[model samples]
Target: MAAKVLVAYGSTNGSTARIARTVAETLRRDGIEAEALPAPSVAAVTPFDAVVVGGGLYAGRWHKDARRFVRRHRRSLAGRPLWFFSSGPLDGSASERDIPPVAAVRRMMTRLDVTGHATFGGRLEEGAKGRVARMIVHSGKGGDFRDFPAIEAWADRIAKELDNRSGGGSR
Candidate 1:
């Protein structure tokens, strides 16, 4: 049987959700069973063989529900395959440092011992907020920095990794 993977996300304006859905679709296309759902909507991971959790980053913090979900399920997830991702750098060439997070969250990621952690570019709509945001957009930090090809490649890699690990003869 194919492995079932859960792609759960916490998105404020829906970018992360869209990303999760794309990932799930990619996994399915690669012959892995996958489901994309909001982080808070996932009742349990008992039915999933692997988990991918992600969230939208705002003001250097991941969405609260995403953090809560991780904390709550860390135990059950201990021996399972897990990965994490965050999206919120409005600039395409920005580094990970450009999108910082609350210190405690960093510690949480370490504790989780995720198999992979990725940071993707984000998008800021018009009239969003703060002077800094507006200034950045004006200064050329606006537009969708999401790398769809990169996301698809990452999903494909995950599918391959899971297939190899499953040893069910899919390559």
Candidate 2:
């Protein structure tokens, strides 16, 4: 049977959610069974063979829902193959080079023994929720900076790793 993967995310402005969907779609295209869902919506992580958790960064911290999810599922997560991702940089720096996870995320990763992590560009467009978001958008600093190709490549790598672990040949 194909390995099942879950890509769960906590997105404030919906950008990270879209990125999580892209990752899930890429994994599906690579022959893995994958789905993306909001972090708070997931009741358990036990059903997935592997899990990728992502969140939008705000004020140098991960989205609250993501943090809570990891805390809530730490035991189950520690026993499974796990990865993490953050989407929050509003500039091209993420695409240009590696950006480490925030301090809290790093601590969780250590506790969970996560397999990998990535930082992708973020987006803050009009109609975003918070006052700060609206200010940024009005100031013309809000725009989509996500690199879809890079996101797909990262997801593809995860699929390959899962395939190897499942003893399935590369797709």
Candidate 3:
């Protein structure tokens, strides 16, 4: 049977959600069974063979929902193959080089023994929820900075790793 993977995300302005979806899609294309869902919507992680958790970065922290999800599922997560990602740099720095996870995410990763992590660019456009988001948009600082190719490449790496671990068959 194919290994089932879950890509769970916490997105505030929807960009991280999109990234999560991209990860899931890429994994599927690589022959793994994968799905993406919002963090809060997942009742349990027990069904998945592996998990990828992602969140939007805000004020040097991960989205609250992502943090809570990790806390809630720590035990299940620790026993499985796990990875993490963060999407929240309004500039090109993420694409140019590696950006480490925030402090809290780092702690969670250490606790969970996450297999890997990536930092991707973020998107903040018009119609975003918060006052600060609106102000940033109005100030012309809000725009899509996500690098789809890079996101896909990261997913591909994850798929390859999973495939190797699964004997290169249906993972």
**Model 2, span 86-170: residue lDDT tens:** 9999999999999999999999999899999999999999999999889999999989999999999999999989988888875
- Tens digit of per-residue lDDT, candidate 3, span 1-171: 567999999998899999999999999999889999999999999999999999999889999989999999999999799999999999999999999999899999898899999999999999998998899889999899999999999999998888888787544
Clashing pairs in 3: none
TM-score of 1: 0.85
Kindly provide the TM-score of model 2 when superposed on the true structure, using C-alpha atoms.
0.98
Candidate 1 per-residue lDDT, tens place, 1-171, comes to 688999999887677888899899999999999999998988898899999988888788887778888987888778888888788887765342434444656777678777777777877767656676677668866778788887888899899889888886566
Ordered from best to worst TM-score, the candidate numbers read 2, 3, 1
Error of 2 at 113 (Å): 0.3
Residue 158 displacement (Å), model 3: 0.4
Worst 10 residues of 3 by lDDT: 162-171
Per-prediction TM-score: 0.85, 0.98, 0.97
Clash pairs detected, candidate 2: none
lDDT of each: 0.81, 0.94, 0.94
